[model samples]
Target: MSNATVRPLGYDLELISTIYISHSKNSVLPLLVASLMVNDISIIAIDGDHIDDVRTMIDIIQHLGAHCIQEKNRLIVDARDLQNFDANIPECSSTRYSLLLLGALSARLGKSKVALPGGCDLNRPFDFHITCLEAFGNEITVDNRSITCIQKHSPKTEFSLPYPSVGTTLQAIFSTVIGDSRLAIIIRNTALEPEIDDVIAFLNKAGAKVFRDDSNITVIPVGRGSLSAVSHEPIHDRIEASSYAFAAVATRKVVLLKNCPVKLMTQALTILEQLKCIFYIQSEHDILVDGRSIEESDPISVVTQPYPGFPTDLQPILAALCCTLKAVSHIRDEVMPHRTGYVKELEKIGALISSDGNKITIMGFESLSNAVTVNVSAPDLRGGMAIIILAISNGCDIRIESFNQILRGYSRIISNAHILGGAISHEHP
Candidate 1:
């Protein structure tokens, strides 16, 4: 339609659709935390898409008495002149990453007062991070308003997390990387997410020694003046690439995702194959997906897990695609219970779906046709993207309220839709 190529809802595009996503939400926050650990000014040249979250981080940095200047994708952070360590998390800036600032500030400033971190209602708890900070020998107090951290002495050299949590592992690393040079922090049960590996590499390049031995991440602080300014490029967004692939499956188009990190997406690729979706790896960094002939087969089952397993982040989009398949599909999300909030929205447009707690079941439909106008609410980031997939698969007009929810994770989404020949428009109510 609209001169883009002719194909059924789930067919191959005549031309390859090239989409470039902005930097990852997982990368930007850690880079900001790394800047706080150093005593010297660090110039970070970052490239990515999520502008709102980036702006919020920059504001938090400025609030902490660090100077930041941005031009295009690069940000120059002048932390050499940092004066204040206390960060006030405004409601507009209530992101979960804001919690990591506590570890960075306490490591350098001796104390910090930060509001409780906020973000998409994912039911994420802070007890794991609290355990990491307590291992730093810091006195912590929590009230309804904010969290207070006061550093007292050198932290314990080793600790263990109740679960392999990325945030907690990062907290352990950030809080200890600024300790005495002789101190080595060992964390057991550390998360093995690729993003964490990239953050470790960035810190290592900045003069800190961070390595992995088995299931542990060890961080050794070289000294207060050890870090050196360095430019780093974050790994490509694996979640974004997977989202595009799922979109292609739902819409039945041959879409090409360029510059994808195929190595990190093995589980996603395996699930795609199970769905009877025709896809192939064009290269290590590219994938060509032919959704033209999705066959009705056995129901594909998915269980969300940490990295190297199926990612919890892409669960919603994949679930949306299940609605378009010929057989019933099942998804179990142990990471986030509310991740399926968009299912009701899909049902509004004629989808056969049911849920029990964190598990969801979707019965495929031959086609979904809606004559009446429909409006969907996006309560979270991934859920917002799910409804958009529904619109594409159903070939129906969908008005998404609070579209900004999707912006927190996706960059240039409207442009991406246009490039893929999707009819998506924004309206102010």
Candidate 2:
């Protein structure tokens, strides 16, 4: 058995105290809609806090006519009071969640006009989303500015997605759950992400039948029944936990992350083990990481894939780690080619990096000078975190512009950093 006791680092640099990672936006948005579609008054109790994207999803849900009250992290939604079927989605609130709204709104309201959601400039095309929804009988028109959806008729229950796109898969499940009659949905080539499982669990708990297999998820109505209201808490943010883990390793500190769902982070933990990271799984809810031996590991090459693989979300942080280490490393972001743009920004902080297409080559440096006041633009969320880690590791206090990009995913940034003994602050310019 792993010992629960942990020792603090002797270095003057601050180490992370225990931290409770917030609920995942990826999990919360789907659960929010699943709860709303049950056609009843219900209280969806969210346990932990989340970022701006969760709030954006809530606003969209309210605009679609559900009366909702948000107290701290809990949302009390009254779906019976829905007045307007047409949804008015704001531009700033645009995200992949909009696609999920399309599925849920088409089932509940039958029509919606949602603006295209803005996110990291990954240049991910919406064609896959449009294709999957269109296959499910949702009349969708794709325009540069907005997407218009009208449900002409109930769709066929069977679907075989060309790719295991998480957004598309969720759209299928959300649309089918609230149909007028008994329906069965078979989603093949599904994304087996833990967040997807959380959605399935939420729906199943609320009187929907969802089964998971190797590469597919099947959803069936429970005894000719529509969805019912539910109260649920999203799983802890695995990406957030992984980010702090990488930070602990790179900074050579000891950190105990609270409520870290280690089972969901297997792939990431395997990679960390390869990096000579010493970790103790204290319990189902916590993990102790000692990064003192991180310098002993060999250079590693990583490729980003769907779940059960290295997450694309952590690729940038790993690249940042290569900067602080003594070995050359290669990171291939097969998931999003646009993620490589952050490599250019890291150059300003004295990283020897170059990119060719989707792959990034990092030539590790012996030493780096602190950047006193270099202006850095946050190209995306994970990229923004990468730059911040690079700056702090080099003993530099820097200002990052466009930091709201980070806020879309992470909450209480300055506060969390301060708790970890980081001298960081955020201000609007």
Candidate 3:
């Protein structure tokens, strides 16, 4: 857990008006790790709203001898003095992003011992990352606790991922950037997430040659000591923006999401339209979602896919919204099979939800009969958001525990909810 303070949500929270929210910290954290490959200072200007959530990654990099300073929205990272390559500490195990360090560390220091990562219980294995590193001529040993990798003299020139995993794709690119300048590494079937493109743009700006063609990515290795300092601002978080949109629709409120990336949210917007929610794209970056008149629609059937498709991250949020409708909804998450852990949590608060493997069946009710004050716990990040949305939409006097999990992905959630006329507060002991 981080040193940042967390306060649970009080009872009977309701979002009754419009609210404006900032971007998330998801896209910028990877860039921060990429900055470590540079021998010079790299400046990253992140949205201040969720900057506190980035402290875990900064602390992990600092443990590896990188000097990182956070000043409001701006982060200054100096990796010229990085001396530690072993990332077996607790911080590395806190989030799965630490797995990216295997490539960065091995490329810079020749070897890395990274503990197995821990995050949401999404049933995602680390074999994809291991396969990518092993293809790069890195001898890897995995045990119950950690994975150790040592680079060999001759690295493979090409590899292909069995699945389009975003983490494995990033590991392959980072490991290829600074080793064997004569080799041009090719990675096929890579994830086409916008964040991957953001990382590629950042790397290209910092003197790395990385290109993408459809599902394949090519990284032309630059010689050691080639990367230079660069400043980058990551694109807005599409998942965060969609979360707010779902919240608006669930609570029947009008919310104007500022600095939202509307283009990246094609599938989500399409689904919202199906739900009869109104959207006014104020500009390329702003959207006004009016959900005050949401009507009963047909049953919704959604399948989670990669970029440009229905996102698995938003499945929980959508599931929560479906619980309030008069029709049944089915959500299948092919990406993360075990993502339905929150179904039980939602059921605790009078929601009719059931899970069978990766598929979730939501028997929507016309209205919730809230006769008692119920307390529920957040199972994970996205799942927690789902529970909160359901609680507010029903106007149930529910107390939510483990809200810190929700804070991991969302910034200033309670304050933003309050701004939208939600009667929410910290749960005092």
Candidate 4:
């Protein structure tokens, strides 16, 4: 008996592919199609192959909420069986992008209850969500499974956060935005990582009382006010772009990345430069990172934060990529505090690495030999794809369990891997 069944258990779609590849879609297609399925827009993809494109899909779902469907079912969601009974999940509460959902769901229901999100392998001890919600005067109850918020007792009020947890901050907005519409908070030590400012800007646009200084964020909700139909494009998914960019680096080859949103990669590009690698800025959306043989004694320091800083999400991919570098490297995961994983898979390919808590130490191998169908699993999105990158590169037949984790972020991994000349195709586990 195999750990993964020949069929995906309770999953919507599965892929069986041989083409080393992914297909590119106009980034806006999913948003346009899913949001306006009843209108001129229509959503279609060749197969499960293009599903790894995460950011585009997020943006599409967000935009779709504004319009009401006459023939709500008219929008044809035509695609091959990514799976049967594939429930088109409306954008609600998600652990992956819970921060993105906070204000939106709060607007829909004065209180939002997100089933405890499950992804990644991090020991998320930061009770910032509960702490922040309590500060906002909302009654919070945490059981084994989910955190529930109730507002029947407290006067519509305000609260503050000690840490700038992205999800907590968003939840604050959602809880106070309705009724009184005058909810304010002081967010302390909150995440100020890259792209968070954009999220703040979106809140401000919705007629919320949102103000941020060097220290704290304050929000006054408009009680489900109507936001003007937004017509702006989303910032490119820096995390996803960085993952694929690292894939090219892992290959020790030069692959041109179009639409890469180069500015957001300050942390990653800087590391590559410190490694004496080369990257040519082709355009706002294009970057060419040149990989070279790494040094044996190169020491690296990594810490995770919100936006405009090292992303915690990239820690796993960075660790995996560093495994092939010539030098011994170090990465400390200050954000989620998960011991850097995914690199363990590299050991199966003949690399040496060690991790404790959030800290990781990697000793690169001269070359990684291929695997012969190693049973593997993806802890989270980044680590999942990182494993796939290492697996396919080693020319081993890899069984990546829980590929759905990869799908939570990337739209299509198999198709893109093929495009990058990787001999990867999905199989029924």
Using lDDT, give the best candidate's number: 3
Worst 10 residues of 2 by lDDT: 85-94
Candidate RMSDs in order = 5.0, 3.4, 7.8, 11.9
1-429: candidate 4 lDDT, tens digit per residue:
657647543322222111222222222222232222111223322323334334334433444343322232122322111111111233322333432232233333444444454444566653766665565555666556555565544433434466666555555544444445543545555555434455444334434466767646665544433332333233556777777777766766555666676777788887777666666776887776554444425666777766667887788888777766667788887767764567676666555778887788878653444534677777777888777776555555666777877876676566677744576556654
Clashing pairs in 3: none
TM-scores for every predicted model: 0.92, 0.91, 0.92, 0.73
Candidate 1 lDDT score at position 106: 86
Task: Give stretches of model 4 more than 4 Å off.
Answer: 1-108, 153-160, 179-184, 226-228, 292-299, 366-371
| Model 3 spans > 4 angstroms off | 1-24, 51-53, 366-371, 419-421, 427-429
Q: Which stretches of candidate 2 lie over 4 Å from their true place?
A: 1-16, 47-49, 91-93, 180-182, 221-225, 366-371, 419-421
Q: Give the TM-score of candidate 4.
A: 0.73
Better of 1 and 2 by TM-score: 1
Candidate 4 backbone clash number: 37
What pairs collide in candidate 2? 94-117
> Model 1, stretches more than 4 Å misplaced?
1-14, 91-93, 365-370, 427-429
RMSD of 2: 3.4
Residue 256 accuracy (lDDT) in model 3: 74
lDDT at residue 411 of model 3 (Cα atoms): 68
**How big is the positional error of residue 265 in model 3, measured in Å on the Cα after superposition?**
0.6
